[model samples]
Target: MSGATILMLVVGAIAIAAAARRYNLPSPLVLVVAGLALSFVPQIPNIELNPDLVLFGVLPPLLFNASLDSSYLNLRANVRAVALLSVGLVLFTTVVVGAVAFWVMGPSLGWPLALVLGAVVSPPDAVATTAIARNLKLPRKSLTILGGESLLNDATALTAYRVALLAAVGSGVSVVHGFALFGMAVGVGVAVGLILGAAAAWLLCKLSDSLVEVAIFLILPFGAYALAEHFEGSGVLAVVTAGILIGRKMPKMHYATRLQGGSVTATIDFVLETLVFGLIGLQLPSIIASVHDRSAAQVTLLVIAVTLTVLIARIVWMFPATYGPRKFSKRIRERDPAPSKAVIGVLAWAGMRGVVTLAAAYALPLTMDNGQELKGRDLVLLCAFVVVIATLLLQGLTLPWLIRRINLPVDEDQADALAEAQAAQQAAQAAVDRLEEIAEAELPTGSTIVDDLRTSAESRANAAWERLGPQDESRLETPSELYRRLRRDMLHQERTVYIQERDSGRIDDEVLRRVQRELDLEEAMLDR
Candidate 1:
């Protein structure tokens, strides 16, 4: 594509994403629909979907950002569920979907080709799942499991896809050998990711500038992915591992760095996700053009059958994977309470596939080992596209409504507020202790500053505790709340004076800005 076309696509995608957000619609669904519609316009250029770009360029940062934001502690607590869905379910879906595709398509496609199609559509898209789940405010554990599964499942699916693709092209490997390869890829990928993550963290700590720190993180994902792929490892896993590691280490870095890094990643994620889903839709014309020697009825039947197989397989596997362990193992039953049937139903429906499916399908080589055209390659691509669309449209669109209908027990916002209040009280007490200790050692024994600082710290702690207290309409302002309001008003007055001084040429712009920044910080502390 030309530079002009790329610019237009980016602008168009941003516009569509903004519109989607404004209307309370999912951006991925909107982007895909828009791209599909735009593909038919004669004036628009045919933008080819490059598999290399999607896999290497797009997948790494997207995975890295998601993993970085994921709770490492939560993931560890829920490791069993995540592993079941990410690794076990992905492999099972690949086999079940492949078998169903083989049965529907008949002998001409062969087992290898059918399996290839299955592998392509096996993993749900982390980007799509995280985006929708975050917006819908699903249960905390469900969100964690879904997010964690999405992060890791791509590596499993892509590795399986590669193995299946090799077999399809006559460079076949035995089942035992394929499993060994998969193991090696995961092990090596994790090692590479850890090394890269540690090195990046060390560098980030050394850099005081927030912008530079953010820039380093921007490069970290792609570098880790490329390095791991060069060493015959799974790039997707490598990126994810690095992200989680670095995210855990972020608290040790400067607060400004964390703030800046968060903003940068959010922007990057929005742009890349919009472009990727839109690109998925843009490939519709090519997919349609490539369907040769098959009747429309045959194609329609194959798409429907394969799509249903994918959905049903997830539901079948999830129920057993979810409750079976608790039912059989006394330890599991005592340790982890079983989820309700409604929660399980939501989990089953949340397995919507996305861009990774399309990228893997498009990555298939054009020919086999004997130089004959690869059988059913285009058909596989079409089937994969259909599955992505079907799951995203059917599952993504309905998931929010399902969650509302189920009315799960957890209230995420209330839980978050309580947790925040507890943490704040502890932090405030620590600050007060440290302040008194410093005052005793380095200042006059009866310093007024120490008393003032202690009072402020106590007020802050009391304010946090107030959040958990019952609200009374008659008694609107507690002592802590009144303190905060007065402080905020004082800061606002100071800010007004600073602006007036600057406007009247009594203070330089630089001096005014520095003073205003200090007031802003003070106001921010009161708000916090």
Candidate 2:
């Protein structure tokens, strides 16, 4: 149907997901099933999406936003494991998959093309795995490894895919050249991202208006990606690099900047995720059409082979690759943290494919360089669909159960403590800044209210600072819980007043904007 129909489907799916969550079911699985059922309805028109729009338009910003939200400093602290998994592990899986697919399904395609297909599906989607991983109580190191691997492996897989595709298209490709290109792509992308990220942050700092700061955040990802891709570097890598740079600097941001910026970014990410999932669901019909000609037995075999290939490849790579470097020296073991077996198992199972894989596969040209209609293109699409469905539904659904069965408990107490301490520090700092501003402005001598406000704010600041104590303390007490409760009540009252004022036309647009930002910040802080 129209774009409105697509919007409705997404809304309906979100409602179902909420219901499913309340019932302790996997919301993603519910969404997938609902999407499938909706797709079969004759009245719902098939979606014809531009691959460029999905990849360039949708993927870059999503990648950037995810990067921005992640803690780059923490990610860097565990860089070794992340690198091993993202680059080394991805290559290992691709080789295993390529070899197996060639051996088992070569009758469907030639070796080169089958290898290309294997490379295509190798990278795990960070977005999907992180969702499930976040729900589980895994070790911090393990979470880092999983999240880091998901974020970086896309660049690696994409590089390999490009080489493989070019070779398949009769472009001459040397092993040395391919390796050089891969290295160059990553190097260039990272360099570009860092430069642009720093520049964007500098601009945001100078720009006082919250909306302008938000707009800068929005533009950086696309701008970085386009510029990198134009220069023959990896856009995915560029987006991620920019994100990491920005994220590392986020804590240093001013309170107003952090609040408004985070609010805007979260809104964008939520909307983007909804659109991405809905678009993914909308592709099912075309996938079905591709596999329509295959016999049940053949379809079943292809599905099983691809499924097992993905499953086994991860297991094979994770165990030895994780432990191998440790054997060289105890120093390495000391330097590098290891993932718990249960966490490893959960990560292995969390390899759900999503928008990136689908976009890449569907983006395949209709013909090869030889002007021949692409053979087995439909089969590749079918297998990719099967993998996406199986992983998103089966593994995604069972992941929480596996984590619990293995007794992997997450320690969010640490997170809460850190958040509280940070909040108190920020609030105190904001108060100090406000007091300085009031002093500089030289308020009227008779204004007792301003003096009273200043004294109260300064008192609160001093109280917060005393409670925080020494920086070395493992735990610091905070008035944050009480503060949060009071703030929530304050927001509720303000919201009620704002609604009344708006209805009575007593507040202007500027007033509404200011109040809206306050409400948005209060809601976000309360969310978890």
Candidate 3:
């Protein structure tokens, strides 16, 4: 594609995403629809989907950012569910879908080709799952499990796909050998991720400039992914582990670095997600054109069968995965209560596939070992694309409605607020203690700065308590509230003066911006 074409595609995608958000629609769905429409335009270039670019270039950052934003604590608590879905369900779906595909398209497609198609469509897209769950505000545990599964499941599906591909290419891979390879890939991936994560954390600590720190983070995911893949490890798991490790260490970094990193990752995630979904849509023309040998009825039947198998396989596995352990183990019941049926229903319905499926399908080698065309390559690609579109459009669109219909218990917003308030109070108290120690050790007489520090800490602690406690009736307004109002008013006045100076040509635009930034920072502090 030309540079101008790429630029135009990006601009169009951004506009579609913005419209999706404005109408409270899923951006992935809208982007895909828009791309499908654009695919028919005569002036538009036939942009080829590079599997390597999507996998190596795109997958790492998306995985990293999702892992970074995920709650490590929640993930730990839900490890059992995550493992069941990410590993057990992925493998199970591969077998079920593959078996069915082989049964339906046997003699011509063969078992190996069937398995390859199965693996391609087995795992749900991490990006799509996370985006939908967050937007719809599903149960916390559901979101955590989905997020955790999405982070790691790609490795499982891709490994299975690789093993199946070897067999399809007539390499004669055994089941035992495949399992051994899977284990090695996982063990090595985790080890590499830990090492790289620690090294990145150390480097980030040594750097002080916020911009430089953010820049290092932008490179960390790709570095981890490339290093792992070089050693034949699972790049997906490597990126995910590195992200989680670094995310846990973010608290130790400067607040400016944290703020800047968040903004950068959010922007990267938004742009990549838009492009990916749009690219999926844009492949429609090519995919349709490639199915020249198969009759339209055969194609339609294969697509429908494959799509249904993927969806049904997830549902069939989830029930046992959800309740089977609790039924047998007393300890499991006591420690980890099973989620309600409604939650499980929502989980089952949320298996929408996205870019990863298409990337894997496209990554299939065009020719087998004998140099003849790989059997069913087009069929597999078409099947994978159909599965993606089916789930994403069918399940993604209906998921929000399902959640609402189920009326699953809402998240505990009040309890969460209380917890945050309590944590803030503790932090404030620690600061006050530190200030007292400094005053006692450094100066014979306490400085005014010490008094101001104590006052500020106390005010913050009191405000946190106010969030939890009843209003004080004796006073018209709390002292902290009054102080915040006065500070905000003062900052507003400063901003007005800066604007006036800039408008009157008394100050340069740059100077006005600098002054305005300081006021904005102050206002943010007051609001917090």
Candidate number with greatest TM-score: 3
Global lDDT scores for all candidate models: 0.88, 0.75, 0.88
Over 4 Å off in model 2, which ranges? 1-26, 412-528
Stronger candidate by TM-score (1 vs 2) = 1
The digit string of per-residue lDDT tens for model 3 on 174-227 reads: 999999989888988999899999998887877789999998889988988898
Put down candidate 2 lDDT per residue, 387-480, tens digits, no spaces: 7777887788787778778887777666755666567667866876877688668866657776677666665554445443544465443454
Which is superior by lDDT, 1 or 2? Answer: 1
Q: What value of lDDT does candidate 3 attain over all alpha carbons?
A: 0.88
Clashing pairs in 1: none
What TM-score do all the candidates reach, one by one? 0.93, 0.84, 0.94
Which pairs clash (backbone N, Cα, C closer than 3 Å) in model 2?
1-45, 137-410
Q: What TM-score does model 1 achieve against the real structure?
A: 0.93
Model 1 clashes, total count:
0
Ranking by TM-score: 3, 1, 2
